[model samples]
Target: MTNYLQLSNITKTYGHFTALDDVSLSVDKGEFVTFLGPSGSGKTTTLMIIAGFEKASGGKVEVGGRSISELAPHERNIGIVFQNYALFPHKTAVENVYFPLQMRGVSRVQGLRQAEDMLSLVGLKGFGHRHPKELSGGQQQRVALARALVFEPSLLLLDEPLGALDKNLREQMQIEIKRIQRSLGVTTIFVTHDQSEAMSMSDRIVVFEKGRIEQVAAPLDIYHRPQTSFVAAFIGESNLIPAIITSGAGKTAENPTLGAFQYAGDDALADGQKVTLLIRPEHIKLSRSPVEGRKNARMIVETIVNYGDNALVIGRAGDIPMRVRVLGADVVIIKEGEECCISWAPDAVFVITK
Candidate 1:
């Protein structure tokens, strides 16, 4: 768990337009961290800075306890895979993988042999003879990955490597990439706007927003206990309600439309404090009538979105929009434009003060 990579007070600016502001983070050796955010949120900018392709306005980029800020992208000894596989169409897979080692003065015989071994690690051993055009998108990605890892760089940066693939291939590559990353034990940084991709592949997720880091935590923590409203709303389907604390010690808050609610959290909230209550859609139970002993609300169903195994019920409860997740079979019990009862226990409510 040693801090193998450190970005201390990193900042980037283009004239008066600041792209990143005082951004800093530490990554442990062999840890898989994903930089997740929307476009223009600085995630890609941070990745570029770390790769030495973009210089920082301030602060340092360190790897293995040494400063790499002064190094060129090639001299930094880091591997990068972009959204485009960036394979040489004319070169065979093995040859493409060997190109990096070839540049470093390794003999073609030795480099190709090492490249073959790396290709095997990425599940492309027998297919190395095929040119980029002969390989499928996923296989081409594996070749690109093998090429990046062939030199055994200090770090591996994947910038939306699965972006161009079909859905099934993207998911399959997620597993393969993680397997290859774990096998190599390379400290890696992944950049993506895909939330589910980040959630599935990362050991930790760093959420960025408006040129700053919003929160960094495990996937579940970032989803269930997000420190800010942005993080809560950004990571998943959430019904966020604005409320004022009526009794901090009582663990209660009151919304003008939804009435009083008991939230579950250990934060030190004060009476009359403004806050937001986050209730995940899945936490709610949609029923015909009030479920005794649980908090209940009447929602006029507006839209029903079904996804084979489950469905989302979107509607308004009083003045606040609400969403409830129900199994596909149970969703038949209600219809759009019909009123239904949505209930949940106190523990289902999470408080967001930020």
Candidate 2:
């Protein structure tokens, strides 16, 4: 795919503090890309740079083979939706959606009709007459999305657009956003620290930490084959065990507390190489006794967090803290403060050398 948006060596700073460091990435046309990381990781900074809201210390921002780095935010033909929907309280839903078109010199008669059509497209059909206060959070979100797309922008930037809603509404909007994005096929950049949001919505995920890009890959690849320990740990709940390669040819590693482990990878690992082994919580099995044909460890159950469908068993095997995810029904077999058996297959372990 051709690169529709290009950020080359983008850097940002504030006095002595560096916010973004030589960050570069290419986005394909119509791809829904997510910039995911914790606060101050430069994901929002990069989005602002692309939108021409923030000036990069040193870099080039290009869109559709043209440089837009020097353009004003309004001149960049990009639509931005922030954490707050930022709808006008005095205006009706359709009026809010039509504001951008009105600013572009479209006639009210024409713009309002177009806005109504766009609202219908976003599942807000007859709600055009209602003000922001009259609409539900999800409806307001849809109104915001309609406004962003009403102008048919070259790019759409969403900065944690669903951060305000409660859990159920947030999930509902996730599906709606993905549906709308797919229908419009607009090249989009979504910024959020929520892992599940990034995993479910993006065509590709850009992971950031400490103002640097950690890994850029599909959501599953980023989870299963992370190139760094930070990516492995940040993307999900993981048990990261420090180990040294005992047999590179045999795909074996030795951890001081966890003993020997057989990891799954084909990297040209050298004997005595230090690495971190990533084992996700759901990959482990918890039972009363050690299971046959799997690596087992005895863990002292410390805490149990139940979430209806599943339960998180947090405990320690020796000094190594571990977590196991089991079905809610199965979690009843173990109690806190009791010794239980946890086992995993060899292929469940991923080796992260970085």
Candidate 3:
């Protein structure tokens, strides 16, 4: 795919501190790419640079094969939605949506009609007359979205726009936003610390850490084949065991405390190289006895966290902490403070060389 948006060797620094270090990425037109990382991980700083809110200390920002490096925020023709919605409280929903078009020289009669259509598209058809205070959180979010899309901006930037909504509303908006983006076929860059949101909404996820790009891949690829230990740990619950590669060709490694493990993939790993092995919790099975034809280990159950549909069985395999995810029905077979056998397949083990 052609790069609709490109950041070429972008870097940001404040005094002696570096906020972004040589970050580069290419985003396809009409694709939804999420910038995901923890707080202070440079994800937001990168987004700010792309939106022209934060000037990069180095590199270039390009859109549609042209340099937008020097464009001011408004001149960039980018629509931004903030965590707080940033809606005009005194203005009604339609008025809020109309403001952007008005700034673009659209007439009151035409802009208001276009704003109503946008609001209706966002599922707030009859609520356009209501002020921000009169509308629900989700409604206000719809208005924000409508306003952003009203002018047909070149790109859409959402900086944790769902952060202020409740869980249910946030989930609802995720679906709504994806639908709208797809319908409009607009290029989008979403910034959020929420991994589940990234996984659910993004076509690709770009992981940021310490002002550098860690891994940029599809959601499942990032989860199952993490390029680094940090990606494995940060994206999901994992049992990361530090081990020495015993046989690179055989795909085996040995942890000092937890013993030897057989993995599925071959890497550029030398024999006796120290590495970390990642096994997702959901890939492990717990039972009274070892399952046939599987890698088994003994774990003393430490804690059981039940979440109705599924439960997390936390325990220790020797000195290594292990977590097993079991179905709610299967969790009945085990309890807290009990000794159990945990087993996983060789393919379940992912080796993170970094």
RMSD in Å for model 3: 1.1
For model 3, the local distance difference test gives 0.93
Residue range 1-354, candidate 1, lDDT tens digits: 899999999999999999999999999999999999999999999999999999999999999999999999999999999989899999999999999999899999999999999999999879889999999888889999999999999999999999999999999999999998998899999999999999999999999998899999999999999999999989989999999999999999999998997988888799999999999999999999999989998999999999989999999999999999999999999999999999999999999999
Model 2 segments beyond 4 Å from truth? none
Residue 220 CA error for candidate 1 (Å)? Answer: 0.4
Per residue, candidate 2 scores C-alpha lDDT tens digits across 1-354 of 679999999999999999999999999999999999999999999999998889999999999999999999999999889888999999999999999999999999999999999999989999999999999988998999999999999999999999999999999899989999999989999999999999999999999999999999999999999999999989989999999999999999998888997888878799999989999999999999989999999999999999999999999999999999999999999999999999999999999989
Q: What C-alpha lDDT do the candidate models reach, one value each?
A: 0.95, 0.95, 0.93
Which candidate gets the maximum TM-score versus the true structure? 1
User: Per-candidate TM vs. native?
Assistant: 0.99, 0.98, 0.98
| Clashing pairs for predicted structure model 3, backbone only | none
Worst 10 residues of 2 by lDDT: 259-268
Runs in model 1 deviating more than 4 A are none
Query: How big is the positional error of residue 169 in model 1, measured in Å on the Cα after superposition?
Result: 0.5
